[model samples]
Target: MLLLLSVCLIAQPATCRDEQIPVGGGAANAFVCLRNSQSVLAQWQDEHPEWHVEKWRCAANAAPPKKP
Candidate 1:
């Protein structure tokens, strides 16, 4: 039972997004899976030091953001 519960929790869907500085001098949104977000973002930041992330957000589902 414990193993089953752990599997189910691990299977949950997740989405992550971040706003990063673009070369044009404005922020651009980048989306990535939550599980690999950190490593992916780190590599990107390392390769493109000028495009540092400004903000980040993660959610459990793929649902689109609600309109304000």
Candidate 2:
């Protein structure tokens, strides 16, 4: 489990992606992508209990950006 977690990396784009989501073609429900990160975080945690992805918003493969 740890190995799997270490290999998979998930992160938002540098600029981030935002879009307006409409339910039933803008008839019933409304959705926003401003902070959809929480959902992704929850999924990672549930998928990998052996690893603590919840601690960081990124997967284990996330290494610190190299210095110039």
* Count of clashing residue pairs in every prediction: 0, 0
Per-prediction TM-score to the true structure, in the order listed = 0.35, 0.31
lDDT of 1 at 18: 34
Name the candidate that leads on lDDT.
Answer: 1
lDDT of 2 by residue, 1-68 (tens): 01111222344223222221121222221122214445554565677544443122221223342211
Clash pairs detected, candidate 1: none
- Pairs that collide, model 2: none
Instruction: Please report, as a residue range, the 10-residue window in candidate 2 with the lowest summed lDDT.
Output: 21-30
lDDT of 1 by residue, 1-52 (tens): 0000000111332332333222211212233344445654576567755443
TM-score of 2: 0.31
What are the lDDT figures for the candidates, one per model? 0.34, 0.30
